[model samples]
Target: MKRKINCETARNFSIVKALEKLGHFPKKSNEKEAWFLSPFRSETQASFKVSKTKNRWYDHGEGIGGNVIDLVCKVLTCSIKEALSFLNGDTLFFSFQQQQNLLKKETGIDIIKVQEIEHPALIQYLNSRGISVSIANTYCKEVWYLYKASEFFTIGLKNDKGGWELRNKIFKNSSSPKSYTYIQNNNKQLIILEGMFDLLSFAIMEDVLLNTSDILVLNSISFIKDIEKFIHKYIIVHLYLDNDSAGKKATQYLMNKYEHVIDKSSSYRNYKDLNDVLSYENRKEI
Candidate 1:
């Protein structure tokens, strides 16, 4: 029998989880609350807040605040029933476990173990994204994590701060101490990218090794400001960000702020991002 979902049950869902599902990951988070860039509008600073204790969200930019249901309605621009249905769809595995021990261990998700990328499912996921197994094993790791009290695995890319950008077919998340991944080659040229997949896609398309250039994966666009201090050091900065409004805005900002900054997004203008172009090309050959 199908379980019935009402406003009461729907409101119990985690607002932070929903925002992450919508691609609005946290800029910073603690036990009590998490901050994210407003999903309603693009801004440099994160003004959206999700209170983990209250299970509610407040968008300072919009001057509005509400519960999970209200957040879903606003984000999807849908009716109450539709919002309930949406919440119900993922309710079974909907975990908002605030266990004190888990929180102390890691902010949101818990890392069980990390090994070389060898899982068949993970391999398939990499192939689907046009990343070869050899390249994946060379760069990424098979990270098995505990979420909702269940073990799941994904291709994990480590950042400078020792956090992991966890991604698979269905789930996309990051561990605590969220920071950018900088692969320094001690070279004068630097290439900037958005996600781990973008870095892998660039490697595949350009056929270059990690030491070819100093690479910086922002992991999230919100971290762009954090990289400002050292970004100017590179003689040439190539940005292969997504072909979206935020990406364009960031590219323009960098170009205006520094010399030798180049927008490499034009190469994949027709696609959403570098990974999208690679995925499309891979599909063509199949």
Candidate 2:
């Protein structure tokens, strides 16, 4: 037998649990209220709020208030019936639970040390990639980490979830949670990157990025679906993806779906990605 839930049942469901399926969680919470970064737009502050006692939500940024069903309709862009179907569906329930399990404690990662990015080997590695040491230092940390029972030092880029994306001349991995690294701004413009290296490359190549526009480093292409909700709010979105097949398909899908989406891959038309372009340009100067 199948359990069919009505809109009445959904109206009383928990918005916090509903949002968990959409990857929206409270930045701060208590017994009364839970505050979150607005799923409707990109902003530094947490403007969307949920009332634990009442099981209702209010997005102060967007001036919207509703129950769980309405919240689902707004966030997922689905109609009432569609939203109801999703609320009653098993797929989202399992995904929400799986995400919770994956993010549980974010254990297995041990930080042996953290220091300034000034080591000669690390500095030399940055220079070889044409990255400015000072710029890299602002976004990256020197980390001595343990993985697979072995210890190694690497350049670490912190994700929005407080997990570090660890990279070096050889080792490339991330602490648990594996979330996106969001550089937030109030600007209507948005730039998306596949990795932190590309973000560092953008900072070096473009002089206007002194926190002027919002940027998101997905860290992995698998994050595309997770970040898609935040992308539509941008008036203009520049996709700085690689020249490879996967990047091409992603860029194409995004461009076709959103009129504001633009492929900026042509800037690095001859290279694999923006980092490669930066390296090639730097080599030309040598």
Candidate 3:
């Protein structure tokens, strides 16, 4: 029989619990109200509020609000059915347990049992991506996998999914379609990039230049909407979007709508992205 979905079942999957799952916590809580750091933007202040009685959330910074499901949908960027399936712990859809078990049996290795990384190959993979070994170590971990009864290792980025976005040595692959690194300073300025490699390349090039600017990598251009509110909040936004036609279109679209956002594409007009520029001789030295 097809089970029914209801608001009661949905509300049981609390917005508070979902935010907590995403490493966000309420700054203050009482019987009625819960205050939290804005999950939509990088902010030290607690601007996101939840009414426990109503099971509703409001982001004062972004001026967005709704029920618990709305919060989950926004955070995961998934549809109502997807969010419901996730909340229900549906084994067929987005089950982390199933994925972990599958990863374990296929690799003949337990992912959780894998010890601390001391792998040089993983380090080299980060280096190839223009990410320094130290920076990679700060944000990611080396993971050993058993796939098809073969043992292999990959560099994995910790994601909201609680799954590692694995980048294998042979293919340079990522498990998630979204592969962007995010960094926020004091939240006054914002810098946006397209991909992980481009973000790393930009970091290498503008390490000293980016002091207080928050960095966001879109992973995919589709995630751009996720950060739109943040873009509106900040005073200055430096868009280092890719040099490709799609990138140009996105940049132009954003520039037309946003007054504070600046297109920094003139500098990389000849290259496809930051990594392409960084790959050349004498480019790495800069």
Candidate 4:
């Protein structure tokens, strides 16, 4: 058991805002009720309900309901004691609200500068993942942006849809109007990857093969439905995705929808993903 010093405060804190941090923004909401997709599981329909009047939540899918503390425990997979410690520390709560407010107040990602990928720190970071400078330079640009009044730089991969997928050692974020990166040439064959790093890993492994077809890097799985129409245009579609539950679900989703869709995760079956596979291979070679 743990002390209840912050229990009451944590209980009454905005569950809505907290859920937003968990990427569970409500699909529909009124003064009393907010409904969202069950963040705990993969589902198309929204089943998670948040009651502002009661300041509690019920994931109808999970058949369970509780206050903010309970929700945090479930999200973090931690104990009530651990949850309380986390809440008292005020990391998630304060940080989330601050970030949310910043988004509302600011215009969007403010590009301070765009440069070549020559920063030694960034190069070292890429080297660890088996991505060479030349390969990264071809597809990625070094971008410095301001978010929430803090200046940061990352390797930015511009998507076809006029937004950037930003990444670095400390942070991972995509610019507004998120969409997949499509390296298109031939529409006959399509290679679908979950993230930019995976796409980069694939490019490094098989650069010649990459040019032979179009590549679609989802950037985030939220764009899965958005890319349905585009995927149909390709005669052959190869999926290289993470082996986790969401990835497995996405793989199955594509398989059921399209006849040509193929899961190519066998190469990295033992590892987490393509990047993992590439890094491990590089280590073995050394």
Best by lDDT: 1
lDDT of each: 0.77, 0.75, 0.64, 0.75
**Order of models, best TM-score first:** 1, 4, 2, 3
Q: Could you tell me the C-alpha RMSD of candidate 1 in Å?
A: 6.9
The positional error of residue 20 in candidate 1, measured at the CA in angstroms, is 9.7
Residue pair clashes in candidate 3: 107-146, 107-147
Instruction: Tell me which residue pairs clash in candidate 1.
Output: none
In order of appearance, the predictions have TM-scores of 0.68, 0.61, 0.53, 0.65
Q: After superposition, how far is residue 181 of candidate 2 from its true place, in Å?
A: 0.7
Q: Point to the candidate with the largest TM-score.
A: 1
lDDT of 4 at 174: 62
Off by over 4 Å in 2: 1-107, 147-150
lDDT of 3 at 244: 55
Model 3 lDDT tens row, 1-286: 7665565678766778767654466778998989986554333357789988888898865567998788767765457887676566563543222322222111233354344445776665565556676655655677776555545666666544344545433323333333345676777888988665666576678876565678786655556666786787788898987775557888898899899999998888887677667666344575
State model 3's lDDT: 0.64
lDDT of 2: 0.75
Q: What is the lDDT of candidate 1?
A: 0.77
Writing each residue's lDDT as its tens digit, candidate 2 over 151-171 gives: 656688889988777665533
Return whichever of 3 and 4 wins on TM-score: 4
lDDT of 4 by residue, 1-286 (tens): 6555476667777889877654456778999999976655434457789999998899865468989888877675557776676555444432222222122112576888888998776887788788998999988998877765786677889887777876664335567666778787965998999887898899988778788988888887666888888887888899998877667888999899889999998878998789988998888888
* 3 against 4, candidate with superior lDDT: 4
